[model samples]
Target: MFSKACEYGIRAAIYIGQQSAELGRRVGLRDVAAEIDSPEAFTAKVLQQLVRAGLLTSVKGPTGGFELTAQQLATVTLRQIVVAIDGGDMLQGCALGLPQCSAQQPCPLHYQFLPIRDQLNEVLRTHTIGELAGKVHDGLGFLKQFT
Candidate 1:
């Protein structure tokens, strides 16, 4: 699982990517936050982290907004976004929250969880923002819960 900030970061990135790639427009912070159903202040902070990590670009003005280039949308994997917002520890940390869990001194669930973790890492590494956004653009995916 990801932290709240990271969750919002992923949602924000996908929304921005969708707008940029599908709508061919940059998105304002207000619009991004509204689309993701997140708080503007918190989303702003998360967006800053993505911008600092070079995952998203920001501009300031009436027409300025956030966007990812085509290259970025195509190449920026979920792993990179996760790392940028949550660090690499989520992929490597023990599922049981043991401080010293490892192969040499495995936690009770470590071995069992290893395969699951490996699979998650693989999916994150392979799934690009563009792929996810395209799903939304194509109406095959929904970012927010539907009533």
Candidate 2:
């Protein structure tokens, strides 16, 4: 699971990447928020975090907006975004929120959760923004819920 900001951050990145790669254009904050169905203020804050993390670029003029370079789209992984917004503990935190929940002092579900957590970490580390955006561009994935 991810924090609300992290969830929106991921969606915003995917939408921005999809637009940039498919249409070759930068997306304004309003457009990004609309596409991802997130509040403009919250999305702006999340975007700021991504921008600070070097996963996104922002400009200020009328034609200015947000975008990721081709290199960034190709190289920025979900893990990076998650860490940027949620911190490195997103994947490493104990499932039960215990202060000491490691193998030596395992929580009730620590052993059972280890494999699942490892798998999730692997997936996040390997999946790129470009790959996910490409899926949306190809109509195989979506960034927003459909009614």
Error of 1 at 107 (Å): 0.7
lDDT of each: 0.94, 0.94
Q: Stretches of candidate 2 above 4 Å error?
A: none
Over 16-79, each residue of candidate 1 has an lDDT whose tens digit, in order, gives 9999998789999999999999999999999999999999989889889999999899999999
Q: List the residue pairs that clash in candidate 2.
A: none
- Candidate RMSDs in order: 1.0, 0.9
Q: Runs in model 1 with CA error above 4 Å?
A: none
TM-scores for every candidate against the unseen true structure: 0.96, 0.97
- Model 2 TM-score (2 dp): 0.97
User: Candidate 2 local accuracy as lDDT?
Assistant: 0.94
What clash count goes with each model? 0, 0
Residue 49 displacement (Å), model 2: 0.2
Q: Residue 18 CA error for candidate 1 (Å)?
A: 0.7
Would you list the clashing residue pairs of candidate 1? none
